[model samples]
Target: MRIQLTFVLLFVAAVLQAQDIKISTKDNDLKLAALPYYSYGKGLGITSADSLFQLNIRFRMQNRIGFIKNEGEDDAYDGQIRRLRLRFDGYVGNPHFLYVLQLSFAPGDVGEIHDGENINIIRDAAVIYRPNRNWSFTFGQTKLPGNRQRVNSSGALQLTDRSINNAKFNIDRDFGLQAYYLNEKKDQFSYNLKAAVTTGEGRNWTKSPDNGVALTGKIELFPLGSFTKDGSNFEGDLAREKTPKLLFSGAYHQNNNARRTQGQLGDDLYQQKTLRSFFADAMFKYNGWAAMATYMSRASHNPVAVDPLDPTLTNYAYVGHGMDYQLSYTFPTNYEIIGRFSTQKANKDIKAFTPDTNEYTLGVTKYLWEHAFKLQAEFTYDRLSFNDGSTKNNWYVRFQIEIGI
Candidate 1:
């Protein structure tokens, strides 16, 4: 296994040690609470009397119904739970140390079935160690610092779902070590740097294939200082900033000897190939308006892989480029209208397997309680162009509702 049996044990002092004990443990000072406290969107929270240990419980569900129409095919419709997740975050011992655990309960949220099997429901199991105000380190499984769209939480998006560009090139999540540093100053130049080393396999990686691993680096700079209300992580200009705010970012990632068609994901490749990706994106918000753009490109020295033992067996690494742009405006009534355009091109080497595509989507959302509880509806026009100069088109219509504590 990639972890090589490297195990970390966290002995949390639960709030059940009120039996003649001053504290559960030296590092912890939590006790049973008579009642849990509630917040608008923060869910249920509790803090120890001594304020050493704390916890928050939150969960959300996305119920959706959709219909699709193809140019020359019969119409199809389906309804199901899109996402169901439970999240817990709190400080354990040291205030600088934090723990986060998230689990996926929706069938689709778990993972795509590979060989009739899915991964563990666990989505995030990580700990953050912030030694100082400017630095933090993370260990365990979590989302990677890839494109801003990929790094952003799904619950924070204005769109019914992420753009097609993210589905194609996002590195997603893995088990690894990540380091982050930030130098921020309001009304001044602010920047952040991120780096990670991960086993180039999914969290369920069984064997550590030779030297297979993924390396990533990212940097973001805010020329005019940070956006109010942590605008960078959520879509749209909910904060309605009076002054303009801008952010620019770039990232690079490399997966050596990857065993999947899409590096860290997709059908298990019987062969391996080193894959590289380049990314650049920017965000801007001003006067109740917001816009964001992203670009990604992927390449491999040997896009095609062939088994040494079986000459006829082969696999091809997904290689191509994708780009998307999003714009939205929030009204004083807590309503928002959003539009997006995205395109993807598969390298000629693998064009037959994938296609060059274009997409346009328009959506409207009503914030019942910010992102925690909302109603959304969208329509999409999709076009697929093949290497043979042939094209196909489809249309999608959907509605969704999200609610949580």
Candidate 2:
């Protein structure tokens, strides 16, 4: 009881200090306001807090209605609330530290009801310290700074999801620390680069040993130019000007665990795995049409099933690869027609997971009711091939209607 009371007092003391600092800034500083903000889609956010020390909240809800044909049955269903996210983002005054806490409720509930109620932590909490505009350091439970395609959030991506290699490398999310740097006005070109050190296990923060750290980095190119006749703007423009952008990213992850010994085998074996990946993506927009293509490959050590004859001997080898593309055309009425193709190929020896898949999709999306609501539909064809000569094909049609206020 005494320890709990002491900890509460410490927290109160910290809050008092923070309040004092915020009061000093308000006396002779710019007052920042928060609340009652509007959002149109996702990009280029403009929002602020009531004061230097304040809390910000953002919420989103999504639904997926589709029909899928599994091995035996055709399941036609409308899945609602596919994603429900509530996020909190803000900063402290004196420390000047930015923080984000994102909670995904639907996925958590789905995992519990679907996967035997396995205990897991699906939410992410991160704290970033920006010493300057050019450099920032982040430490927390979050996604690693890997390839551009993987780093890009689903809310901003142009496709349904990431490619096969990305899913295979499973760099989805991990607990780690990152250092990011950007040179926005370097001559005629600008670039964004980030480096991260993390546990190789994807989203397995508890199982990670302290021996190894995964290293990843990305580099993107930006074109510079002007559109307006007046020479008033010095920073340049993005929406008015038209240009192409390219991104290249790569990562290397390795881990060495302590050796294990068996009494009957009279031998020792160490579990060590190494992975390397390379990715390239390009996006171009001309007139009312846009094009995007991405390619990535991964090489990693995967162990074969254990041998009953000799428990001491094990089999391990390396391989995987994948690619995807998107072509979209928008009409004057803001309606879009999109076609996408993706393919994957992987090593023959690995069977626990294979990357040999092909998919083709055609989609159309239009805005209605003063462009405040979106109606979209798509048809997809997927083909899967296994190393054991087992093949499967599937067709699905999806329809979605989203509205914002």
Candidate number with greatest lDDT: 1
Q: For residue 332, give model 1's deviation from the true position in Å.
A: 1.0
Off by over 4 Å in 1: 1-40, 112-118, 207-209, 307-310
lDDT of 2 by residue, 246-265 (tens): 23334543322312111001
Tens digit per residue, CA lDDT, model 1, 18-116: 123332232221110100112236578888998788898888899999999998999999798999989887787756577778899898787665664
Task: Supply the TM-score for candidate 1.
Answer: 0.88
- Model 1, residue 310: displacement in angstroms? 4.3
Q: What residue pairs are clashing in model 1?
A: none
lDDT of 2: 0.51
